[model samples]
Target chain A: MQALNQILRRIPVWAVYLLGAIPAPWLFYQGLTGSLGVDPIEALEHRYGELALQLLIVVLAISPLRRFLGLNLIKFRRALGVLTFVYVSLHLLVWLILDVQVPSQIWADILKRPYISVGMAGFVLLLPLAVTSNNLSVRQLGPRWRSLQRLVYPAAVLGGLHYVMQAKGFQIEPLVYLSVIVGLLLLRVPFPSLLNRFRQVDSA
Target chain B: GVGLAGMARGAAAQEALEPNSWEEITSYNNYYEFGTRKEDPAKYAHTLVTEPWSVKIDGLVDKPGEYDFQDIMSEMTVEERIYRFRCVEAWSMVIPWNGFELADLLNMAGVQDGAKYVAFETAYRPDEMPGVQYPVLDWPYREGLRLDEAMHPLTIMATGIYDRPIPNQNGAPLRLVVPWKYGFKSIKSIVRVTVTDVEPPTSWNVAGPREYGFYSNVNPNVDHPRWSQATERPIGGGLFAKRIPTLMFNGYEQEVAGLYEGMDLAKNY
Candidate 1:
């Protein structure tokens, strides 16, 4: 764990950005080269979507880890969140531009498929969060900034639901990520201070 | 894996294998994977290993026997049958399946007169197949048909696909492939095929008896509980504009639809 942390610390933030950016180009190049074997666009979409979800899970884990484990890699959270948004945006763009060429059909698919509906909700909610990730926007928004960032929780749930629906035969891996986000949220909720006696005993 | 080599041997026994593009293969999946998702089979099937298999033929057969994987292959001729596979979920795939007639196998086994139905079961291993581990589906995948459906000329005891011994991803070793019905009717990785007098409850039908029926014939009119029954997306096409008009009995209505002339297909489905 220490080695991983040290390695992560050494890598420049741009390197993280570039690392996140690589899969898109690599998959696109595979598509261009016809290495995806068949239905390159759909394959590309699946790859991008999966990677985007993974990045989203990683981003959601940041604050929870800091609070529980006292690991303050706080500087990377905003960048990681933005990276997730970038991957998700690419995923949506690939679907819109390549998979469904017609605007009406894309609209129809989003409206018709319940899974797509939740996924679109996540995408739409992520837009404002991504836009506000910058320091200037955060400064402009001020007090409302924290509230705007709260959208991530719902966005995470929606994103997880999209994956759950996509899975066949009740895969629980996606649900675990959803649970982690829910657990983190639960940790923040105020409780009756029965812990005072326990803490006092510990200190004594 | 040993199965991969077995497949190579099987391919060598036949003519050059028909190597399908991933689009053609992935889109055209046997519907047992995710209820009715086109890509679900390929995705969930990563958990399946199609090697070290056998088929037990029991109950009301004159020559009741357990056929090992190797011997089952030596018995039949693998002919290419390119049929249109229509799913109840409103998707279709033109699969170039390579398998011989189930009739030949049954005749070899000498099925008795009292055998009224043929029940098929998949190998139920939750540890190996994560799909089985989940409560989303009932354990031990199952499907059944009236003895006549089993005897239908279109019914094939498929051991291979694309002129090759079936890939682990595509119900390898031994499986039933009934072209006329919805793809789920073709049970994958079959371990047992029992001849019985009573109509057996199939997996999906038992899961949602009202929605999925015993006779899940490919009827365009009988809509599933969730989706339209009228059309299907041909594998290899994009989400939009690629769905084609689903044929009645998957274009085998003339051959098999007569088997269910008066029965309410909607009720049975």
Candidate 2:
């Protein structure tokens, strides 16, 4: 496990970016070749959304991994975040350019549909985080940068909720994703501090 | 010579219509009875018992009884029809169906004067259909049409596709094919055909009345609450293929527009 961690740490962030970009071309190829089944556009769109969510989950897990597992993958976190944003932008673009071509209808869908509204909210929240995910932003913002990047927590929750609402009927897959996201968020909570506060309250 | 001329005419008619391959038609489906996924019905519908089928013709019909599948087929004169099937989800397909008109079946049963609506029911067998185990929809999916719409010559009781028995996924034994309405209006695996004095409850309308209505006529102008009805992607069209503009009544406006002449389409939708 120590050797694996050393190897993981040695791997360049650019390599992670390269590996993350592989699925986009493959998906496009499948779509072009008619291998994406009956409704390829819908399939492509779904894949992009799922990939973005999976990447977001991985991004959320990075800090926990470094603290608990002794696997420092901090260098690649920004690359993963940027890749997640790229996937999310692609997902939104697919809906805009391919699915709903008309401008008025697209606007109506984003405004009217609860799922779309939530998804757009998540995307908007992620936009600033993606833009500021750099060494320069980190140097400039200092302590404030960490607080700003925490927006990913709400963005990730919204992303999960968007998936749950988009499903036609009661589906277990989206619910499972939501549970995992919630679990990840809960792991970040400072339980010791909360317990001390509770003890103080009881004494008072 | 007359038979040869008739064959030639049939060939010409088929040539004029957009051809949907047998593979595409067989694989893609939206039968919720088998499952919610589009391909679920095709994957899981093999368990369905279709050979020993019967349709229960009840309610206000004069000759109300359970009609045997074989008997119904023997009595009817079947013909091939090429139709454009539009789904409420804004997708479409060109299907070649072989069946007799619904009017013929209704005429056989002898419709009662008081009957104003034709309510249809899909077969519900929990043991065979795994989807029925879940309340994805109220079991035994139901759909209805006005008596006039039921009696229209364009509305057919489809038994076969591409000169073969309709696949289990595409509602084996018997199914209604209402060309002008959205695909859901053409209920699959029909087990009951009831002629009623009042409008009957439909599964979708019961589930989400705002999203699905009784009329469900194909109108590009009236968008579905969640999606646009202005355009539809043909099932077999490639991934990057452009969606075509959806037609009013799915391009059957001339034949079916008069049916809703006095009613407001948006309200009905």
Candidate 3:
């Protein structure tokens, strides 16, 4: 267990990213294979979307995880967030390219559909967060960086709402992810100073 | 009541007067793609391949024949019937479908005794079918009905939409098009039909049983667990349009209500 933890602790952030990308090629191959069972395109689109939501939750949980469990997954935060963006972009692409097909219909559908409108809102909110993910941007706007990252909280909620509204029913699975996001966000608020200091010192 | 029947007959008569065009038929759709977006399926499903088809009729049936595209459809009289397809997704499409009545074809099949329900299955193969690869829905599309429901006059096995042969994506060659129920109940691109004694679990129902029932009648009162079934926006109205109130059994309650007597839809659903 110690050796395993040590290996996990030492693995570079980029390695985690590369590992995540490993599924993209396989999914693409599956998309071609017709082995995706029932609805291949929808399957791929959903997989990308669901994983993106999961990664968003994971990224949101990082600070709280570090603060609570002394597990510094800080190195993975940017990569996870970026992967979330990558998947979200792919999700949007599938909707636009395969589902929408016609340009005029796409415009009208997005404008008219409330779920699509909210879903698009979530994607748009994620854009600045994705674009400004670099160290250069963080360094350039040091004070603003934290505030900008805060967009993820509402983005996650909006995304959850978008998915819920789309399903048009109470699907319990997505609700669990939403709960995790809420829990992680709740954990980040200023706790009792003694407990907070204790965790900080323990981590140090 | 007498006038309404005359009006319906008149409408049916007028339907025969002007055969629908392919553009009007193809553009209008009941597909639930685009997050159950009514208008999206016709657009997205253009890439589907509907040719080179065969339907396998098995299970409780005696013959269990593997029917080709030509053989099953060869003898049946094709007619243009304009139907108001009300989806469980709360959208509607008035399609001028070109196909024979399902009862005419089922009679040809010679259904035997002990056959209580009729189950339909779609062609399963995802390579040419990109939609199959997505687990967004359970694969090998399916829908089922009690034998009485299967034999209803309005139950049609459609081969074409909008006067032209059904586009490959729209369940070409043959598809079950029950006008009264939600779109999913009308299983598309049908490759299999079985007369089964047991109630066969269907695709969407298997995906989420509480939300999708086997007998998916178009009742506005019995809402899908997630969305209201009270209203549906008819297709061709484009965006920002008014949705007419959906009728019980899609306005076929008078004809089909007898089939569900003594059975509570709320529990059965």
Cα error, residue B26 of model 1, in Å, equals 9.2
| All candidates in order of TM-score, best leading | 2, 1, 3
Question: Which runs of model 3 end up more than 4 angstroms from their true locations?
Answer: A1-155, A168-204, B1-7, B10-49
The digit string of per-residue lDDT tens for model 1 on A1-204 reads 566667768778887788888888888888777666345666777778888888877777777777777565666887788888988888899878775555665786787777788899999999899988888998999999999998988888888788776554555676776676567667666665767877888999
Each prediction's fraction of true contacts recovered: 0.19, 0.44, 0.00
Best model per TM-score: 2
lDDT of 3 by residue, B59-85 (tens): 776677887778877878787666777
- Of candidate 1 chain A, the 10-residue stretch with the lowest lDDT total is A165-174
Q: Any runs in candidate 1 off by more than 4 Å, and if so which?
A: A1-12, A37-42, A93-113, A192-194, A200-204, B1-54, B60-63, B67-78, B86-93, B107-115, B124-139, B162-164, B167-169, B205-213, B218-245, B262-267
lDDT of 1: 0.73
**Candidate 3 lDDT, A112-156, residue by residue in tens:** 667777788899999999999998999998999989988988899
Best by DockQ: 2
**Proportion of native contacts in model 3?**
0.00
Best by lDDT: 2
User: Which residue ranges in model 2 land beyond 4 Å of their true spot?
Assistant: A1-12, A62-76, A186-204, B1-16
Q: Lowest summed-lDDT stretch of 10 residues in model 1 chain B?
A: B11-20
What TM-score do all the candidates reach, one by one? 0.76, 0.89, 0.60
**What global local distance difference test value does model 2 have?**
0.88
The number of residue pairs in model 1 that clash at the backbone is: 3
